[model samples]
Target: MKKQTINQKIEIHASAEKVWQVMWNNDSYKKWAAAFMPGSHYVGDLKPGGRIQFLDPSNNGMESDVESVTKNQEVTFRHLFELEAGNAGKTLGDMREKFELVEKDDVTTLFVSSDMPEEYFEEMNTATTSALQIIKEMSEQ
Candidate 1:
């Protein structure tokens, strides 16, 4: 099992607080993470040691453990799921998705970083990319 790290960034016009609000708020999970939440936005907690669960009607949901969290700064977590029924697939290990906020005069940079297994690293990449795109559009909206 090889470990891999992934990094992605997106500069938004809104503040970090604004982005975080839309990103973690369980109520708006469907608005942002709609790719995962196909039917509706389920309940979840965005706290350290908290559980971030996403439920979909089509059996495409995941539950993870909130390993650590830094308010308005970053959130680290681990994802556990069975690749195949009765068989523990590959644990993504620990995924530390850090959202670093920095203001450059007018534009605010939202840098995202994650560390996970190679197979699941692509999942983070795709999800992060989609999330950032939705965020940018939502910010404009």
Candidate 2:
């Protein structure tokens, strides 16, 4: 199936470096994504080609290999496993998510955009906002 994209933007009340620190910390993802699946972890390095997963954490996490990552700038990854048993039969494609952080007048704005499937639209949108909020809060903290 052809991939679809979803987009959201967030403004963080923190500096770009502070946001980068928390984002690449590698041990704090659980505090955010857990709200989506009850268990989520920092599964890989924060650099380009690093891997990560957002899963139940009860069963093993569904894996997604990072396609490209740029510190405090952008990150994109692909879903390795089929999202559902149904995706196994089709020409499944990659989902690309980018986080573009821009600073102006001492304010930071995070622009998030994703290429994903329709079914994932709602969840990703909600999660994206929540994740940004958490990151903003954590960065300011």
Candidate 3:
């Protein structure tokens, strides 16, 4: 079966740098990301080639490698595995997530795209929508 790619976007009336900060800063990230997993926060750096684990309060989460980072422009992460009960299970297929920012006329357009198996389409769609809404609110503040 072929996997699907989903794209979600929102325009924030803030600088790309500011949006990026709210999106990646651990505390702010946890707030918005709670839409997907309550108390979600990442445990790692945002530099390219670094390992990042997005975890919930119970520590259940997914681990990925930061494939690329371009400051306020873009960030790509490649899924490596899923952590459950403190055990890592190899990811069965390719799953790459990208966050891109385009600023024009003082408005920053943030786009989040992810590639994953079809089974996750709905869940991702809903989560991304909710997350982006929170991002919009935060950046507009």
Model 1, residue pairs in steric clash = none
lDDT of each: 0.65, 0.67, 0.89
Pick the winner on lDDT between candidates 1 and 3.
3
Q: Which ten residues in a row have the lowest lDDT in candidate 3?
A: 85-94
- Looking at candidate 3, what is the lDDT of residue 94? 78
What lDDT score goes with residue 101 in model 1?
A: 67
- By TM-score, how accurate is candidate 3? 0.94
Q: How do the residues 1-141 of candidate 1 rate in per-residue lDDT, one tens digit apiece? A: 576777888888876667677777665557777753456354457788887655565444456677777765677767665233233444555544556666666666777776666777677678778877887677655
- lDDT per residue for candidate 2 within 19-53, as digits (tens), equals 77776665666676655566665455555667665
- TM for every model, in the order presented, reads 0.71, 0.77, 0.94
In model 2, which residue pairs have backbone atoms overlapping below 3 Å? Answer: 4-116
Please report the candidate that would top TM-score against the real structure: 3
lDDT of 1: 0.65
The candidate that wins on lDDT is: 3
Q: Which 10 consecutive residues of model 1 have the lowest summed lDDT?
A: 81-90
Q: What does candidate 3's lDDT look like per residue over 1-141, in tens digits?
A: 467899888999999999999999888998999999887888998998899998888878889999999998999999887888547865736789999999999999999999877888899799889999999999999
